[model samples]
Target: MPRDPLSRLQWLVFALVSAVFTTVYIPQPVLPVLRQTFGVGEGTASLTVSAVVLGIALANLPFGALADRMAIRPILLTGGLVVAAAGVVSALAPTLPLLVGARFVQGLFVPALTTCLAAYLAKVMPAERLNVVMGSYVSATVVGGLSGRLLGGFVFPPGHWRWAFLVAAALLLAATLAAYVGLPVEDHEKARQAEGVRFRDVLFRHDLFRIYCVSAGGFFVFSSVFNYMPFYLHGAPFHWSTRAVTLLYLSYIVGVVAGPLAGRLSNRIGNGAAMVVGSLVFGAGLAVTLIPQGWAMALALALVCAGFFTIHASAAGALNRKLSTGRGRANAFYTLFYYLGGTAGITLSGHAYHLAGWHGVVALAAGVLLVPLSTGLVEMRLAQRDGSATRSSVARAR
Candidate 1:
C-alpha cells in the first residue's frame, strides 16, 4: 500500500475502533439515569453494560477463528451493521429488558470489529511496527471511550439519553461504511497460516496466559471503578450532577498519551518491567480514590486511567510479540478475557456497592489487582532468567 493511503487506512481503523468503543460505553455514564428510567436497582441497571461484555466474551472465539479464515472487509461490514442496528433497537426499545437485549446483540458482533481488526493489523503490519501501531490502536480506544461518556452524559440533555444511542448508532453506521470502502482486502492464502492451531493451544501457553491475565486483571479494576462511579458520586458527599460526573471521564485523555508511551516503555524495558510499573501506579491510584474530596477524585482517576492503559498497552504489545501465527485466535482470547473481567467486575462490584458502597467495591478491586501485580512479578523473574541464560550461551560461544 502507498504511504498516503496507508495513512488514511490507519485513520479509518482508528475511527472504526473509536466508534466501537463509543457504542460499547454509551450507557456507562448514564447508569444512574437508566436505573431511574427503568425503575430498577443499580445491579439490574448495570446489566446494560455487563450484558454487552458477556456477549463479547462469548462470541470472541468464533470471530477470532474467522479472522484467520476470512477477509476482514465483509466481517467489518457485517459486524458494524448488526451492532448499529442493535444500537438503534436499543434506542427504540420500550423497556429496559429490550434495551439490554439489544446491547447484548451488539456485543455478540463486536469481536468482528475489535479482535478481528486487531488480528488484521498484526498480519498486515511489519513486525517492527506492531507495538507502535497497537499503541495507536489503544489510544483510539481512549478517544472512543471518552467520546461515548460525554455523548451519553453531557451532549444529550437529561432524560434524552436515548438520543445518545441514536447518535452512536449513526456514527457506527458511518464508520462501518467508511471502513468497508477504505480497508484493504487481504488474501487468506497469503496471510500467515494458523494450520492446526486450536483455541486451547494459545490459552494454555504459560507466557500467553500471563499476558491474558494482565488483560483481565487490569480491566477488572478499571471497569469496577468506572462502571459504578455514577452511583458513587450521586449519593456521596459529592452529590455531583450527571454532567459533572461525565466531566471526570476527561481523565480518560491521559490514556491516549499513556497507551503510546507505555508501548515505547515496553519496547525499551520489556513488557514485564512495564507491567510492574503500571501495576504499582494502578494500585496507588485506586488507593487515592478513597479520599472524599472532588479534586482528589479527579486526580485519582487520572492516575487510574494512566495506570490501566499502561498495563493494557504493554500487555497487548507483549501478546503480539509472542505470536508467530494464529494471531486471530490469540487476540480473540485476549479480548475474551478482557471483557469477561469487565463483566465479572461489574457484576461482583454491584453487590459490593449495594452492601457497603464505594468502599466495598474498592476492597473487592484491591484483592483483584493482586492478579496483575503477581503476574508482573513472575514475568520479571522469567525475563531475568532468560536474559541470564542468553548471556551465558553467548559467553560460551565466544
Candidate 2:
C-alpha cells in the first residue's frame, strides 16, 4: 500500500489549528494583570478569559456548516487572518470594553480555524492513522495552551501585557503562512459531487445526542479546573507570582504523553470504556488537588492533565467515527458543546470560588465530572447490549 499524503496534511493542519487556539488563550494567565491595569473587578477581568471561549462556542456550528459548503483551506485562511487581526486589535485596545470586544472577535474566528482544520484532517487521513494523528493534534493543542499561558505570565510583568498579544499574533501569522503554503487545496466541485446526508438530520439522532452531551460535560469539568487553578493558587498560602503560577501549565506535558496513548487504547478497548475510565481518573485527580499544599497541588495538576487528555482524546476520536453522516457537522457540534462548557464552567466556577473557596470549586468540578462519568457507563452498557444483539442476529442468520 502506498503511503498516505493526507496524513502529512493532517499534521500540518494540527500545527496550524493549535497555533490559532494558542492566540485565543494567551490572555488567561494575564487576566489578573488586566484587572489591575484596567481597574476592573475580578468578575469583569475574568471576562477577558471567558469571552474568547464564548465566541468560539457561538461560531463553531456556523463554521462547521460552512466547511461542509466550502473548501476547507479558504475557510481556514480567512479564520487565521481574522484571528491575527483580532490579536493585533486586542493588543492595541485602550479600554477594557474595546479589549473585550476584540477578544470576542478573536474568538469568533477561532471556530473557523478549528472546525475547518478538524474536518479537513478527517477528510484526508486514513482510519488506521486517524487516532494517532488526532492524538498528536490534541497534544499540540496542549502545548499551545501551555505556551500561551507561560508567555502571558512571563512577558507581562508591569507594562508588557501588549507584548504577549503581539508575540501571539506573530506566532499565529507565521503558522497561518505555513498552513497556506503547505496545505493542499480541496477541490470544491468534487466535494460537491460526493453525496452525503445533511447535518441537521444528524443532529436529531438520539445516539449522537448522548455523545454530544458526554463531550460537553467532559470539557466543562476539564475547563473549570484549568481556568480556576491559577486564581485559587494566587489566593492561598502559596500566593505565587504570575510567572510562578503560570509555570503550573508545564504539567500540560502530561497530556502530551497521554493523548496518543489514550487514542491507541481507545482503538483496542471500546471508546466508551476508555472515556469512563478516563473520567474516573480525572475526578480522582481533581480530588488530589484538595490537599492545599504546593507539592500536592503540583501532583494533582499533573493527574488532572493526564486524565483530561485521556478522556478528551478518546471521546473526540469516538465522535468523529460515531456518526454515519455529517461527520464535520458532528465534530462541530462536539466542539460547540465542548467550548460552551468551557465558557460556562469558567464563569460558573468563578462564582463557586467566590462562595465556597477552592474546596467549593473542586466540589463543583467533581460534580460536573460525574455527569460524563455516568454517561460513559451508560454508553458502555448500551454498546455491550448492541454487541450482544448483533451476535444474536448473526446466529439467527446462520
Candidate 3:
C-alpha cells in the first residue's frame, strides 16, 4: 500500500508464498481429526504433514541448482501447476496411502515456489534493501502458515477436512497465475551471471554449515512442538475442542512482527548476537509450555513463534549476505536442512510423545536446542575475531 512502485510486486510475491505454505500446512490443525477419519495411529496421521516436508527436503537441492541455471518463470509455472494438481488429488484420495503420496508430490515442488523465488529475489534486489525485504519475505510465510491452520480447522472444520485441501489448491492456483504474470522476466545475462559457486563449495564451507545447522535446530524444535500439539491438548487435563486448538495458531501472528524486528535487530547488533538472544528466548518459551493453564500456554507459544522467527530471519540474512553467487544452491541447502530437521523432529517427537506425553517431546526438543545455541556462540566469537582483524588493518593503513 505504500507509494513504493515495488510494493505491488512484493504483494504478489507474498501471495504466492502464502498459497504454497497454506497448501503445505492445511493438514496440520486437523491431524487429530485425520487420525480418526483415516483410522490411523498418531504417527501415521502425522505423515500427512511430514511427508510434505520430506519431499521438500529431498527436492530442494535440485530446485536450488535449477534456479541458478534458468529463469524462475518456467520453474514457477510448472511447479505450481504440479503442486496444485497433486493437492486436488489429495482432496479426492480414497485411501490414506494415496493421500500421503499426493501430499508428498505437493512437497516435491514447493521449493520451486519458495526456494527458487528466494534465490531469484536475492539475485535481483538491491543489496541495501535485501535484509528488510527478506524479513518481509519471512513475514509472508507467517501469513501463509497461519492461514493454512485456520482454513483446515476453522473455516472448513475437521469433518470437512478434504474440502480444506480443495480450497487450498484453488488459492494456490490463483496466486501462481498472478506470480507468473507479475514477476519480471529474468534475462539471459542474469542467468549466465548466476553461475559459479559449485555444490561442494556450498556444502563444505564452515560458515554456511553453521548457518544450516542453526536452521535445522530451530525448525527441529519448532516443528516438534507444533505438530504434536493437537494430540497433547486433545488428551489429558486439557480436552479442548478442535476449534479451540486451532485458535491457538493465532499465536503465529507474533512471527509476522518478529521477522522484521529480527532483521532490524540483526542490523543493529549483528547476526551473531541477535541469534544468541533469540535462542535464549526460544528456550524459555519451550520451558514455559510446561505450565498447565491455557493463558500460560498461549503466551508461551507467542514467545516460541517470536523467538523462532527471530533466529530464522537472522540466519537467512546472514546466509544471503555471505553469498556472492550460487545463492539458489545456498538457499536450497538452507531449506534442505530446514525441512529435514522438521521431518526428523516430527518423527522423533512422535516417539517421544508416545513414551512420556508432551513432557517427553519437550525434553527431546530442549536437547536439540543446543545446536542453535552453540552455533550462535561460535558465530559471536567468529564475528569478534573478524572485527578485530578489520580494525587492525585500518590502523595499519592509517
Give the per-residue lDDT of model 1 (tens digit) for 201-311: 998999899889889988989999999888989986989999999999999999878877997898899888888889888888888888999988898999898889888
Please identify model 1 stretches exceeding 4 Å from their true place: 1-3, 123-135, 188-194
RMSD of each: 2.1, 2.9, 2.0
TM-score of 2: 0.91
The superposed Cα distance between candidate 2 and the true structure at residue 246, in angstroms, equals: 0.8
lDDT tens readout by residue for model 3, 296-365: 7898899899889989988988898888876667777888999999999999999999999999999999
Evaluated at residue 253, the lDDT of candidate 3 is 94
* Cα lDDT listed for each candidate: 0.88, 0.79, 0.88
Candidate 2, residue 148: CA error in Å?
A: 0.7
For candidate 1, what's the RMSD? Answer: 2.1
Score candidate 3 by lDDT.
0.88
The residue-level lDDT of candidate 1 at 121 comes to 82
Itemize residue pairs with steric clashes in candidate 1.
none
Model 2 lDDT tens row, 1-398:
11576556666766776787678678777777787899986668878878998998998887776766677777777888888888999899999999999999988988777777777666656688766766656667877888787778875662587988887898888888778778766667644443276667767887787778777777788778877777778886778878887888788888778887888888888788888888888888888888778888788888888778777777777776776667766777777878888888888888897899888888888888876677678868988998999999999999
As a whole number from 0 to 100, the lDDT of residue 125 in candidate 3 is 75
